[model samples]
Target: MFYDVRRIESYSLKISIENGRVEKVKFDESRGKAFRVLKNGFWGYFVGDVDDREGIYLAEKNAIGKGDVNVLNVSSGGKFTLKPKEDFRDVSVEEKVEFLRDVEKNLKGDKIVSTSVTYFENVRRFSYYDSNGNEVFYEIPRIGLIVSAVAKDRTLQFYSKRIMKPAGLEALKGAYDIANEVVDVVTKLVNANAPPSGDMNVVADSSLAGVFIHEAFGHAVEGDHVLQGASVLANKLGQKVADESVNIYDDPTLREFGFYPFDDEGVKAEKRTIVENGILKDFLHSRETALKFNSKAGNSRAEGLKFPIVRMSNTYLDRGQYKFDELLEIAKDGVYLVGSRGGETNPATGYFQFNAQYGYLIEGGELTEMIRDVSLSGYTLEILKNIKIGCELEFDPGFCGKVDQLVPVSDGSPHILIKALVGGS
Candidate 1:
């Protein structure tokens, strides 16, 4: 028999300004606990706002059914408290509003008809203790700023930029540059031409390529998906999956938005190599999945009071030897896509489709004109094999959704050259 208890206490704030007007400023607090028990090859789970002993009793009582669920035994214990250089509470709401205004001012333009800015800061305190002598706790802050604008001429176009990190107020130091970038993209988008159709060579910026790998490939490597036979990579471990030049990693230790000292399961975090030079190496795993697969455990994570599940933290394609100019040169006559608006991917089928926020047409190894409504789609494995990676990797932070739970994550890569179908949507 085994048991564990997890609890989370959090405080968060959100402030937003719209079209040069202060719109909403809100604060929130939440706390919850979860209990889990394993007995007779069955597991029981309960989440609530109850005391430790009562929670454990409820969980054990709920473990009345029979199932073949077992968790790996690992001993891990630690405590981490990240002290922000400047505490978020030290900044007044008025000061935050003014700071947001400073960023919004840069979004002004004749073609720009709408603008908005939102700031978020949250601190979560997690505590965990389990039967295997695993115990851990952490207090970390997550901060983000979002700036966006919409431009209209003969057509409507939208652009947005986000700066998020595991730091405190200091992360907003780049507010000026972020707002300027939002304005620049929206400005060009107003006069940009529609994207060309059909399959063609393509160059992807770090942000776009990051999303590609995270959505198309990351989910497919979660151990649960492999066990369920829902991923195309279910049986491809130790086999070649990408070109020898391609290497991918997911690390929770990075100071990006998804930084976590220890996963919810009390596993000490480490960088996990999913693909190493074309070879499928490992999958993200929760304790149960790890035991079944006879693999190591650590990728398990949970939102407040939710069931622990396999998740990616800061996933990225490791940088390669080529430079940005080299990728453009290799793509000679293709679209250079920058940023990602949104998209869809089927991990079971190894296919994906994504909409670029905007792109520029590449003519004769050089950028020609900005293009709007840009999209790229292809088979994930095919693109992975053909990827010509660039030097200087970077990351884009956002939330990832799985089974109705949203967790912070960052996807990143250097520029890349590949071939795929481009469309205007």
Candidate 2:
């Protein structure tokens, strides 16, 4: 029998503020243990409501079946902690409330009609052990604040910004700036017009470009999807799938929201270059998939007390030498899409549609009137070939959801000029 046990614990605090008043304050602490067993080559899992031996017994009972699930022999373990300076625990709740108030006041505007801000901080500790005698443990503290604002004049528009990092109060140093930017963007978006619709040159700002990379290309390279015949890139490994100017990487070592010293399965993090100079090189993997693909394993991850799955951490498109003006010049008569609301993609078909938070029209290679409710869409394989990567890669943090599980992640890219179909949503 092959089995693993996990003990996960967390402490978190959240405060919600609206229109400069505290709306809610919440604090929570939780802990749980889960067990996974492979009996007769079938995997089974059980979480909560049992002591260690009982949990293992139940898991093994469920795992008893005629099946074929094999895992590579990997003996890996470690202990680490990402300690945050000025821990949120040391900061009083009143002070946290006051901090939110100061940030709320930064959302200044005559046209602004509403504002809401939420603060969150969490400390997570995890322990893992397996029948093979491997053990691992780690602790990490994280914090974040989200601010949203709505404005109305000719049209109602909304905008939001968030700052999440693997730190404590110090992570919110730029909260005021984000608040101001949200107000400023939404204020202008109220008067913004719909974009011109067509297949044309489009320049995606870093945030939007990052979204495309994460949502379209990144998902296509997940090992499980590839193995399941659910990815377009599955058969394209070692071949050119993008322009020679492009390079894409998934690295969890960065100190972004997705940072982790090691994944849940005890595999140490490493930079995996999925695409290099246009060729598809590697796919993200868990140990199970790694054996099938003959690739290194590091991306096995999971929500607390959940079974590990293949996942991405900090994924980004490598920067090119082109500047913002150069990308604008390249897309002389198209929309300059900025930010991301959200998007959906079909990895099997490589088709994706994403909504840009807002954008501007480019005429004669210069920014013109603001445009709202813009969307970009295209086949991933084709779109990658059509992009001209720009300089100064930047990251935007958020949660990536799959199969009802969500994990913190960061996506990044420089500006990218591409030809795509753009329209109003």
Which predicted model would earn the best lDDT? 1
TM-score, per-candidate, Cα-based: 0.99, 0.98
Q: For each candidate, what is the lDDT?
A: 0.92, 0.91
lDDT tens digits, residue span 1-425, model 2:
88888888999999999988888999999999889988777898899847889999988877757677777667788898988877999989999999899999988799999999999999989888888888889899989999999999999998999999988788888998999899889999999999999899999999999999999989999999999999999888899999999999999999999998888877778999999999999999998899898889989889877789999999999999899998888777988999999978999999999999999999999999999999899999999987799989899998998877889999999999999999987
lDDT of 2: 0.91
Looking at model 1, residue 400 earns an lDDT score of 95
RMSD (Å) per prediction = 0.9, 1.2
Task: Say what the RMSD of model 2 is.
Answer: 1.2
Candidate 2: stretches off by over 4 Å = none
Q: Report the error of model 1 at residue 55, Å.
A: 0.5
**lDDT at residue 190 of model 1 (Cα atoms):** 88
The segments of candidate 1 whose C-alpha lies over 4 angstroms from its true place after superposition are none
